[model samples]
Target: MQAFSKVLRLVELLLIVFSVWSCTQERDADVGQADKRTVVSLHLGIKTQMSSGCSSCELVNKYQWNFLYRIFSGKEDIEFVVYCSDENKREVEQNLLYDVLILVDKSPETDELVVCHGRKTMFQKAGVLDMFSMRQITELLMDSALENEQPLRK
Candidate 1:
């Protein structure tokens, strides 16, 4: 009976150790994941003049931009920095010559999407707002994040 009790105690101790080890492993994994996460910054330069009736202004009010903002805002790795031409006159005058400019990760070395007047410039694989699909944007963002993970080339 004493031997059986000893064995039971050993099993209990083993289970406790296993549980602690499992928790440590999970915590390590979480930390690794946090390190791997890439921050994708979406810089939006918007025209605040509603009277201009520019396509870029119209695009801002459209459901697509709002929907995209809502979806991406919930993500852990994506950030949006909005710059209104009216509020940020110096920034607009210095960096942007268009009604709208969307820069990803603030890395001009990477492809950038510029929308102005009624035309849109493609950012590598991502097309203009009117022609760009949600899936394409998602892929673009994921691709950009992954690209940031790679070491810089000399």
Candidate 2:
């Protein structure tokens, strides 16, 4: 009985590993496909600064990627339009929310946008909704885990 249980456990572990590997393969295969999308806009609560990897260009870049994710919701290639502006900082501060930590380690590469799946929304999408901070929206758009459709222009 003990040996049988151990074998069953091993089989379960193998199944789990296989499932994860298959999913990752599918995800990778799905990336870089075609899609219709655009970055609506990112109403940043505070402009990204030098401390983060975010360059002047990144502020808008983040928003662009987010727009694509919102519309496409997959790892497909797409040119997305972005809308960017400032909301009432006074209001954002009143709520006491700021800066999204995209990189766990404070590295320069982390400054660029990181994209990830499994999240339903980003900050830029909410226009004056007061639902979340602009920093978070920027983070979502910039997350490296998230995929990008178009080659960033020079």
Candidate 3:
């Protein structure tokens, strides 16, 4: 029954190949579905040396900025929009305060973080200069995104 034995081995090989192919296809489909999910927007405004005249402004250093940038840049569901006082003069001046209005809507300061879902403001925080504040902001953003995620259907 050499022919029968050969047939059984061939069938086993084919089954293994098909199982791998099926798993790969399922994983690809999951990734495609993830890409279709909504992306939340995070707007950040920071004052630079050029606009550092405000003595009361928060002291947001380069390292703090880089930390936020790294955490959000790698996330697929969050879109980070950074606005430097020196770099984006017009945009920051026009929309910084308008985009970030938490409890009391006032003028834009040195450091601000605004999380938005489409045009609506989901969360906002000001004077985010230290690592502790940054961590809080990160947790808030993640929570907001998770809250905004659509429930899956069975």
Candidate 4:
């Protein structure tokens, strides 16, 4: 009975490994067949501030990635990459490569936006919205394409 149980465990492990490998193979194949488009990478970071004398503190930074993905997935001319990182002061200073570097900062009571240019890599405070909107993102992408002289498909 012991020997039989060992063999069954080994078979289960092998089946698990094979299943994972098969999924990876399918993913790689799908990636290969997908149409390639210009990638607009959004490097985002969060900043938080603590209050000294507060009864309660509430933060509202609930941004959904699926909505953003749905907006760009159907566009053949553009692709988006939203990269989020932990809040670190040094990250703000370090020169990072991205199509757009957005800094999402939250203070004791307000939010701020810092936007960067893709080509020049220069950052500026954008006082456009309380938070990033899809319209702003699309406009930025269009501006980026125009700066690079790339024509949009359809």
Best-matching candidate per TM-score: 3
lDDT of 3: 0.45
TM-score, cand. 3 vs. native: 0.39
Sort by lDDT, top down from the best: 3, 4, 1, 2
> Which of 2 and 4 is ahead in TM-score?
4
Which candidate, 3 or 4, would have the higher TM-score against the true structure? Answer: 3
- Which ten contiguous residues of candidate 1 have the minimum total lDDT? 109-118
Question: Which residues of candidate 4, in runs, are more than 4 Å off?
Answer: 1-37, 49-65, 86-133, 139-154
Rank candidates, TM-score, best first.
Answer: 3, 1, 4, 2
- For model 2 the TM-score comes to 0.25
**Model 4 TM:** 0.29
Compared with the true structure, what per-residue lDDT tens digits does model 2 show for residues 70-102?
A: 544332322222212233233323332223211
Q: Write the per-residue lDDT of candidate 3 for residues 1-154, one digit (tens) a residue.
A: 9999688756645543443344234435556444333233223333456756554333344455455555554545555544443445454444332222222222243344445443344445555456676776667656645665633221
The digit string of per-residue lDDT tens for model 4 on 38-133 reads: 444343322335542431121222232334434444454454443343453234334332333333332212222222332222222222233445
Cα lDDT tens digits for candidate 1, 80-119: 3332324444543454333234332222111122211111
Model 1 residue 93 distance off true place after TM-score fit, in angstroms: 20
What are the Cα lDDT values of the candidates?
0.38, 0.34, 0.45, 0.39
